[model samples]
Target: MLKEELPPEAALDGPPPDADHVLQRTLGTVRRERHDAGRRRGRVMAATSTFMVAGALAGGVWLGQDTGDTVLRGTSAAGAHLAVQVTDTEGGLRLVATVDGVQGGEACWLVVHTKDGRTFTAGSWRANEDEVTLSGSAMVRAADVAGVSVMNHDRTPLITAG
Candidate 1:
């Protein structure tokens, strides 16, 4: 409506529309907006988690096994599989091991068994999931290593690779 139709108290010259008055939203509209916001947050969280995991995996692949000179893969009757990348270093053997089909949180050691019947622990760690990748080093030279085994804390061999 034209300003001429305005009541005297509501004229354009009057004080600007109630400065302290707040706008109210309907209950359903508010609920819907909140729900939409929650959905957006959930999506963002999922994407961030995925990106972080992928970055970690790629970094490991680039820095670890992809640089190894030899890869020894093994399997066990118990359904466990282990792949070890063996790199011969002046100090000994550098081992990058990836194990699968194991229960999470099981304590395991990457033991390098030498040709002369000695065992050197390269690395030991508890499993995180069905699959895990880790690095360890043994004082024994790579040529002297007869085999590698993933051994349980109780001395059982979960998997072996030669």
Candidate 2:
């Protein structure tokens, strides 16, 4: 017959009278650990939210500034001249355009193209004379505008600016 060895502490008659107390202590430890984990999670979430808000504020401020870059300026083969200043605005690209040399009673269009393959109609006007001088504004993203072009109502390209 083989004999088994036992520790001195295992010489109890049966289960300890304090068994329930030990179980309660273990449960209390688990609960405290869970509470600590929840607090940590809440702190992490608050920090992330703060960072997001700061980033949003910074982006808003940046978008409100004027970039001051000229996107296009040229004279068409048919004698239509255009000058444009592109700026980044809160809404989008702010295009201030000046046009000259368009014939009177002719419909002209300003087209803006973006780097992301998007096109926008900025404005339109009717030239009153061959020496017509006019100014207009449009909204778009200065960073996204790849080029600008002036076209007639018949879709003929008058001038293109890059």
Candidate 3:
């Protein structure tokens, strides 16, 4: 059939009579699609970043709670230094203390007394570089140990019991 005798829809199936107008319309559609796609990508990235930041904050809070049960205290004497740390474990209390700076032949002593006057002392003397750890269900009684004391070369109380 002759082009002039065809309907508008059939005419559209043939090559465009005006190439410039067709090209302009196609380019406009492509630009609009690209803009919409960029907007969607930006939204997705923003949501992902927000989720990451929230997750980090939650992890920090969880870590803080996990380590919140421990307490640490430090003191120094004329010839000795002491550091004490107490933590609540699953079964009982855990107490750790470190002592340093004693005479070459001097001995370090650690004594723990409970509120009921029950005392638990190291049978043998501890060295200056040794770390003492005590664990037991009755360890809660350690709250009454007060503090550790150090003795000097002349058997003088470098750190008084408190």
Candidate 4:
């Protein structure tokens, strides 16, 4: 048929549509779209979890860096008074033990230890000083020993003194 010979209504309905073919194409498109959406959601979740873990690790590093050296020393006598010293290197905080009416013939020894396994031992003479100084790098902790008790009144324990 010549192009000019076709009527207007015939041109309007030029090609017959295929219903089954159209439905299949539409269903395939929907399925692909749903699959892509699921993949996008999974990626988002994985990215979020990665970010959370990284943040936690960064926070832990910051906390560890902020904490510095600590020192603990303890002195005690047989049926007498007890003395303790606690120092925080990060904050330069010092707490001296208070012992009232220490009598003669009192046996006392000061044992100092660090979280990093550094130990310092001194006799009652050193404990009599106003302040005992600890050197080297270590995390101060309470010293554990028999016949003596070390308690942390303030700050974290980095060593144990017996």
Superior candidate under TM-score, 1 versus 2:
1
Ranking by lDDT: 1, 2, 3, 4
Q: Is candidate 3 or candidate 4 better by TM-score?
A: 3
Instruction: List model 2 lDDT by residue over 1-162, tens digit each.
Output: 222475332546743555566666887899999999999999999999999999999999998987576657888887777788886767876677777777778788888878887778888888765544444445666767788887889977788777
Query: Please, what are the lDDT tens digits per residue for candidate 4 over residues 1-162?
Result: 898896443546543353366655787899999999999999999999999999999999998884442233334443324445554555333334444333433333344444454544432332332333322222343332122222232322223334
Predicted candidate 4, C-alpha RMSD? 13.5
**1-162: candidate 3 lDDT, tens digit per residue:** 687896443555654565466666897899999999999999999999999999999999988785543444445545455554555556545555555554445654554445565655432254534444433232443455554445443444444344
Candidate 2: residue 131 Cα off by (Å): 5.5
Better of 1 and 3 by lDDT: 1
| Clash totals, every prediction | 0, 5, 0, 11
Higher-scoring candidate on lDDT, 3 or 4: 3
Off by over 4 Å in 1: 1-68
Off by over 4 Å in 3: 1-60, 66-78, 122-138, 141-145, 149-162
Give the range of the ten consecutive residues with the poorest summed lDDT in model 2.
Answer: 1-10
